[model samples]
Target: MAAPSSQIDQLADRIERLLVRYEELQRTNALLQQQVDSLTQERESLKSRLSAARARVDALLERLPTLKNAA
Candidate 1:
């Protein structure tokens, strides 16, 4: 009876430790997810700016021929 009771206590202690670890891991995962979302938004903004810049460059290039002809 004593041996079984000791084993049960040890198992309970282990379970408590595991629960604490699980909670810590959950918080870390949530923080990582937020970082990923922030990076994704920043990447999208940079892509939009790049696209706008490219369009401006293309428009300027299109006008070069007309400018040259007028000269």
Candidate 2:
């Protein structure tokens, strides 16, 4: 049979390692969440700019004379 003291020490070491891993994962998750938020904001800004550009192009096309009208 294994000694009680040695078994207790082994269990304690495993718990400490697990705690360290858990903390590292939490930090990694927080960093990923921040990245997601930044990208989402950038995507929204780009979409708004694209819409404005399309509107400007449409206005310019309307001002141009059509071939049928010119003839």
Which model scores highest in lDDT? 2
Off by over 4 Å in 2: none
Off by over 4 Å in 1: 66-71
**Model 2 Cα lDDT, one tens digit per residue, 1-71:** 88999999999999999999999999999999999999999999999999999999999999999999999
Q: How far is candidate 1 from the true structure (C-alpha RMSD, Å)?
A: 3.0
Expressed as tens digits, the lDDT of each residue in 1-71 for candidate 1 is 56998999999999999999999999999999999999999999999999999999999988777865888
**lDDT, candidate 1, residue 62?**
85
Question: What lDDT does candidate 2 reach at residue 46?
Answer: 100
**TM-score per candidate, in order?**
0.84, 0.88
Candidate 1: C-alpha lDDT: 0.96
Q: Model 2's lDDT to the true fold?
A: 0.99
**RMSD vs true structure, all candidates:** 3.0, 1.2
